[model samples]
Target: MEEEKRRLIMYEKLMAEIDLGIHAIDDSGKTVIYNQKISDIENMNPQEVLHKPVREVFKFNEGQGSTLHRAMTEGYDFRDEKQTYFNNKGVEITTVNNTFPVMHHGEVIGALEVTKDITRLKRLVQENMNNGTRRYRFQDIIGRSEPLEEVIEHAKRATRTNSSVLIVGETGTGKELFAQSIHNESSRSAGPFVSQNCAALPESLIEGILFGTAKGAFTGAENRPGLFEQAEGGTLLLDEMNSLSPDLQSKLLRVIQEKTVRRVGDTKERKIDIRLLATMNEDPVDAITNGRLRKDLYYRLSVVSLFVPPLRERMEDLAPLSEYFISKYNDLFQLEVEGISTEVRKLLASYHWPGNIRELEHVIEGAMNLITEEKYIEFTHLPLQFKRKRPRPPEHNEIFHEEESTPLLKDYLFQQEKTFMQRVLKEHNYRVQETAAAIGISRQSLQYRMKKLGIQKIRE
Candidate 1:
């Protein structure tokens, strides 16, 4: 009996430490029990709430009905963020709330409530609306394309709401670039942007990276702010959030809910104010299925989801992109090469670019360095193994000999002419000018054919 009493006492203490704003409404619609979070949100003490009518305590409307009462009578779960009418202050407060019916054995007895304050978010939203333009908008995104335009548009929407974001794509797809653009366009743009990669940093170092420790917290310790601290009043990006263990995901969930972080070897929790963005190379759902990514963490991140398209899908930017990279590398590598050979473009377009834009950039830089020329790049300047040959057209010498000017078949000759052009490109190693000159065509005309054939490499 003594042990049971002691265990009961410990269990009650455990319930008191819960961070969620737990509330209990009896069948009579009176507040029977409330947790610290609820007390703080309602600006009332537990004693004041013990038996007060919920309507009087919360000043809820009798006609519209309380979400809590609805949950109890209907035995349905209620959850959402809404503007709730206040009695004491006569003002509305936006609350992230969850209400569920409480039952003993199999019988419903009351309803439990959990509420969180989002008033600060409201102010930030209002200020942004009045300004008519955010400090960080989509214009900051450097790319111009249908996909990129859509991505920037979503980033703008994400800033208006304080929901977490998850960016999923392959490596070198500019995940971090997009992540930063989102942050810069968000309400927290003025604050520092802290970025960390779970795959880059080991688990042993992740905790310290997230929650800073004191000077003596560990052996070689110096008082340093973790990424979270640096990102306070700004944004923190975990580039590989799925790499975190299940344990870290739980800790992260607490931080998201409470907006606080406690340093290692510390006794008190420190508050943090920042937005969060995480990235992944794989589907978050798959990660969860395999136990690599936490489901709760996935839920938190997927509130605002954006997937960057692979470069192969954005072929419209190929030529301009090649030019862009050429110009960029021209300054970086100190080269005067105008651009890649026409054949080089065809060669690039023919190969399956699995590596995406990043791969294209590297190839351009590689070819530029190998050329060592000032005028124009040659087909041989590109990676040779990637070049593929086009089939040659059979000579129609019999027809040419049939008459001096046998009825000139235009489109048929054009088809044969186009095929001949492709063969010429292969011969010149896909160098545009070389292929054009060989086919008695100009570089511009060749470019038009390449574009017409939907041939592109190194998408812009």
Candidate 2:
């Protein structure tokens, strides 16, 4: 008898320490056990709820009552049901509950309920939905290269209809730019435009955030509209769509097919009138082959696909892009910078920009910050990361000269020209225009000669 009493005490201690809210009642609907978690969730003291009838301690909405009461009296089990009720103090509480009937020899003895509080999560989702806005449009995209223009044309076509779009590009290739441009150009321009990075949140939370939550979808889930509902009558850009789990990808495919969404843990489905745009940083074929993406979902989202070309593929746009960034910073920094020097342009063109336009913009921005009274961005102004990748110019002592045999006239002339240009540039403190004036040649002529002779200003 003492052992049984000890075991009962141990059980009570474990119940109190459990993370979930636990509430149990007798067949008569009177509370027999009320744990601390439930007390916290309901904002009620255990003393206030213990031994009290559930109907008297809490008030449910019309047509809804206690899940524990129904489970005990009706001998039924309720799984993942959302319940909202007011405590005796009139504070409203929302919970996701799993209520089960406790049976003794096939007869209902009582009921047990396990619950999770999600009131805060619900409030946050509502606040986020109310605050989001779209800022990018087609004109905001900068490049004029054929590869960029071709994709823009396709994106424009995407705006004419409500077809799902899959935008494929490398990181920093501006996939979201096209997605926003499509929305702003389309008939849904007046409505909300929402974007969610699939990789931004964990799988468990993302499901509820994307599809919305029904008051009791899961622990901490509140009845709130997801990204789909928030972007109603407009566009929803799912950036890095391939990052989504396969199960979610399947659900997304279903939503695309049916044009409807069912909130997490809710039985009813609501029709959504929103355009879907998804982006992938990697090739969809590779993503599918590696099992990171679903083939069916890929097919669904690719109805009007676009590939934003990397910066390396469109070298012609470099000059214009650089000029644009220069002008942008000139206004922003309140400076009078003219343009990039020829050598700086050469260095910018030679390196392969792995981060694409974004990297180029950062390089320009970094250079802009270092500018004081300089008229143009020079080779010295470029970032060290860029300089490290390119071959460093040979130092004066490192320049090789023929010693064993007489050199060819072309080779000897090349050496002489390189040596002369290096000396003149050093004298002018590596100023291109000043060096050109000292040599009695046009600035463009001196620049061309320097390029041919492999002459570059060495950093001091």
Candidate 3:
């Protein structure tokens, strides 16, 4: 009897800890087990739902009812069926449920359900549908480098025709910016422009999102137009297209070829008149070799391919990009920050930007936030993480005297302390109180150190 009790406790603990929601009910529709996850998803307490009928605890619109109840009564099983219903508190909840009938002695006794909450995703999709404004233009692209200009010229030409364009570049290389520019410059500029990241959602959900679902298609699917249909007259930019599964790549290829999309679980094909743009973060050849992208789809989409060069490949644009970002943040933060210092510029140019322009923008933004009553962004203003990227100088023990070739430990320590104090003082904008607190020293001690070290705020 003690062993049986321990096993039941273990089962209850497992159910409570699992990420997915778990709920079960008896044949008479009385709630038997309701885990914490399900309670959280439904926004109801276990005390309110336990030993109560599902119909009494939750409200479902006519023709759309509980999957658990259906599984118990009809002996039916549902897989990846989306259900939207109101809980006892009158809060609407959306979930993807897999329900199965529980059987004992050849008779259905209850039903069990596992659910995944997708309420946030549903709201995001709705927001994307409502907000279809095209904000980026060709002029918005910042670089004037040869490689960037060449790509811009090609993108400008792509806008003349409705050919599908494939953009290839590393991550953070502004592939979406180019895609948006092309769409805004295209003939369909007046129409709705929608962009979706193919990797943002799972295959099951993405398939339905990309291709509209018909009513009666799944458990709770409504008659809704997909992104292709929503972007009827404009361009649809699918970011990270290479992340899509091979099966989806095939379906996309068919749509590109026929200019029509068949809704999921629906036979009727609807024609679409819109330009398609896709961006891949990796090389297309690599993606195709790895079987993540379909060869046929690549050919169809690459009718007009534009390769945006990474920031490392176009170093000439660094100065202009940096200045532009400074001006942008100047207006944004309402500051008169004139420009970056020469030392900071050298550091910016020396680092190979693995994250490309986005990283540079963020670095500048961060440095600007630390500035107050300073005209130029200095080396000290850079974030600590970026500062760590600077090349390490010789260690104190490694520094040798010219005559003895022995370590100058005393001189090295004095220089290091002076540099550290100066940097900390500058970081706090020459505020003695803040600098003292930052360095964990009393105000008098910090003042004496500054006097001994000859560290004073110097304006450029």
Candidate 4:
């Protein structure tokens, strides 16, 4: 009886403070005591809450004493981070609650229930999860070329590790896309996948944006969370890591090494638990030599490095992707576009695509906009530069085989420019300017090639 009096005194004292919706109910289901927060959440006064049956508020039995029914029946604590509740007005809200039975001399006497309104919190979390661009798994990466396959294989391998990743590729090569796929496939998929382009922001604002400042720490008056803190237990992709200035690079290195960060102008050190994945277009070696990127940060980031081959190098993936893009744009533009013809295929195959797959996609869509077709994409629909030809007839053996041929960079395209130039001058009766223009070179450059190739023009 003395212990019961002590419990009542403690509950009364707790009622004066402790606000996150706390309530106590006797085994008879009477609201023995409750805090103001509960009444506030229910929009009722404390005087209005006393002596009420908890069943009238909860609309269901809480279980034996404070114990969860599932726990008593299943031999473990029954827990759910999400549970929906509805009010009398048919207004629905989410809640997370924890309950335990009060034991008095081995007999269940009462229950304590702690609940929080999570309806708004759940909405924010769901919004973050449904950010579908990153939600795409490996199966979503649309490519089948050997080079593309290699990248996908590497990305899959990368998903299993927490090590930092450095994806090197030219701009628009889907480096960030690969990073997102990796994060989605990893164990951290349940957590936030935050991404920011380091190159896109200037050095002055980059630090503040990355490591948030406290209230009154800067021009902003509100306390804001940085990407690192927000990405706790998740992945942080620093797109274009190579562009970070040396000072910022040092700060980034410390975060990776120690897993900590200090908010701007705040002496307190906040620890961050984040997985790091970054992309860079510039060569690491060149960046190091030129002092644009720090070598230490590069070493830290490249715990695993992946290269996305240029599009010209992966042309084997061209035809199918081209056809796919044509169809895609046709649907997007509401055009009745058809597939590429044999002649158009020849143009796409022979040209050196410096821009890669992204460039090819743009080229296809651009062509689709101008043409009206149903059966074939004519050669005239291609980019203008692709139409220009070498003056000499067939400098290359020209593989015009069926689409089943192996996709790989051809060796003949690596032939000496001078030899090709000589063949062009000899065939064109040494009209240097016309020959130079036809083969995509200047006359002076052609003359230099003639001197180098020992080709004498038939001077009139």
Best candidate according to lDDT: 3
- TM-score of candidate 1 on Cα atoms, chains taken together: 0.53
RMSD in order of candidates: 23.5, 16.1, 16.5, 18.8
Off by over 4 Å in 4: 1-133, 383-460
Tens digit of lDDT per residue, candidate 1, span 1-460?
6999999888678668876667789988888878777667667668877887777766664466677888899999986635365746565555667788998898889898777655533443243233312333355434577766666677667777668899977676678777777777667777777777777655766677678776656533346566677777877888888888899899989888888888776767888888889999875555776999887777777888877765655655667778888888889878887776666665565443557778778777777777665556677666554344321122322222333333235324646656766666677777777767887755654664554333442221
lDDT of 4 by residue, 1-460 (tens): 6999999888778776775777666666677767877666655566655676654554332432223333333334344333555444445555566666667787766666676654543444344344434576777666688768877898899899899998888777778778888989999988888887777666755676678667656432236566788788988888888888888899989888999988777778898888999988866665777998887898898888787766655666777778778889888988877688887777777755656677678778777766864556777776665466321123432654334333333334334555676677778777988898888866755664454333567751
Residue 381 of model 1: what lDDT? 68
Error of 1 at 443 (Å): 50
- In model 3, pairs of residues that clash are none
TM-score of each: 0.53, 0.59, 0.70, 0.56
Q: What digit string (tens of lDDT, one per residue) describes model 2 on residues 8-28?
A: 999989988998899999988
Q: After superposition, how far is residue 26 of candidate 3 from its true place, in Å?
A: 12
Using lDDT as the yardstick, the better of models 1 and 2 is: 2
* Superior candidate under TM-score, 2 versus 4: 2
Query: What is each predicted model's overall lDDT from 0 to 1?
Result: 0.69, 0.82, 0.84, 0.69
**Span of ten consecutive residues with least summed lDDT in model 4:** 64-73
Candidate 4 overall lDDT versus native: 0.69
Model 3: CA > 4 A from native: 13-19, 23-36, 39-93, 96-116, 390-460
Name the regions of candidate 1 deviating beyond 4 angstroms: 1-143, 384-460
Candidate 2 Cα outliers beyond 4 Å, as residue runs: 1-132, 391-460
lDDT of 3 by residue, 159-233 (tens): 999999999887888998898889888889898888898888787788888888897787567687888998999
Candidate 4 Cα deviation (angstroms), residue 269: 1.5
